[model samples]
Target: MTANVLTIAGTDPSGGAGIQADIKAMSALGAYACSVVTAVVAQNTCGVRSFQALSPDFVADQIDAVLDDVRIDAVKIGMISNAGIAEAVADRLRHHGAGNIVLDPVMVAKSGHALLDPEAVSAVREALVPLARVITPNLPEAAVLLGREDDWTVQAMQAALPDLLALGSDYVLLKGGHLEGEHSTDLLTGPKGTRALKAPRIATTNDHGTGCTLSSAIAALLPHHDMPEAVARAKAYLHAALAESDALDVGQGHGPVHHFHALWGSGV
Candidate 1:
């Protein structure tokens, strides 16, 4: 059976991140993709210029409309810019009994623009984090959620496990992409225990929408694979995308990963 994956996120006109990237990743992985937009963002591969969020009630309505009709096998959530939207998403997901939910704590953009409101951080931490099957947060995002300084090493990430687990999610995938090293590692911890999923740091400047791609890939794979396997596979897919990102020249500042690297063949 084809798995149906829904993405609740904002827009990226550049098609490298947010709803665009989510749909691409899900479809690339052979899952049926659905979307509910939370915001309309004006951004290119370079950076975010501006964004206007939708009303919380309308966001909830969109969720309801989709869940009422479609059998969503899994969901990937990103870029909830405010507290009201966060609460609305959480409430609607709970109301629908949504499963295999993958939450990517999207706080900042690649150009260092703040995508999430300061106040919404707490709302997502409290309302959304607890409901996710797996929450994928980068170092800075994890630090903000925990109200602490960003971690710099694998040991620090390991040390923060107790608190990260306290967020109440079934699994926490703490990404170490910001850490300076030859290998980028992510720590996944849950009832089964903690383990590191590492991948070679691809030498590429076109890494736009990496978080969205990874989380959506996992959500797409969740229906058929276990948490660990899904995450591992997602990491591999992102790595390949990044490795092949230089094939296209989308923008001047930063380019997008080749989401169809395998399907489209080389020289894309």
Candidate 2:
């Protein structure tokens, strides 16, 4: 039987990010993808134009409709949008005793549009992040969570992992793509220890949905592998996607990483 993976996030009409990207990544990794949309986002590869959020009650209804029947093995969360949606998602996940939750704190879009509301950041940090087995935060998202906009060195990311773990997640994966370097590094920290994973930075502008892709890939692989292995494989999958990111020409702005890189003959 195929494992079920759920995404509680907004929708991207452009199919480059949010629920669209999450489902593509999950399905590519052999998981049944399910979704509860928090917002209907009007965006293309260029950038997000605007978004309309669903009612908190409706978001809960969508979550309930799925969790009540499906045996979701893992969940990848993104684009909480507001405090109400944040609290509602947390409530439902906790109610179901959901396992292998991968939280990607998607605060900003690749085009520099704000996906997370400024005020709701606190609600998500306090209410939702704790339930996640692992949290994947890019450098900017980590800075927003930590309230520090300082330059994030590889060492800074390593030190920040434990600090982020204090937010109640069992593990934290701080992605180091935004930092200038030869390799795109990620630090995974947990009770066991901290390990640094790196991949040569593929030069491409088509990285719009990298975070969503990575987190969903992790959730898709979690049922078959241990936590550290899942994260490592997900990072590799993302790196391959980035390597072939130029395959898709969707919009004028930052394009999307090819989620079907393997199927499309990436040979990675």
Which residue pairs collide in model 2, if any? none
Each model's TM-score? 0.99, 0.97
Model 2 ranges off by over 4 Å: 266-268
> Compared with the true structure, what per-residue lDDT tens digits does model 2 show for residues 137-192?
98989998989876888878877877799999999999888899888889999889
Model 2 is weakest, by summed lDDT over 10 consecutive residues, at: 259-268
Question: Per-residue error at 83 for model 1, in Å?
Answer: 0.5
Model 1 lDDT tens row, 42-109: 99988999999999999999999999999999999999999999999999999999999999999999
lDDT of 1 at 25: 97
lDDT per model, in order? 0.94, 0.90
TM-score of 2: 0.97
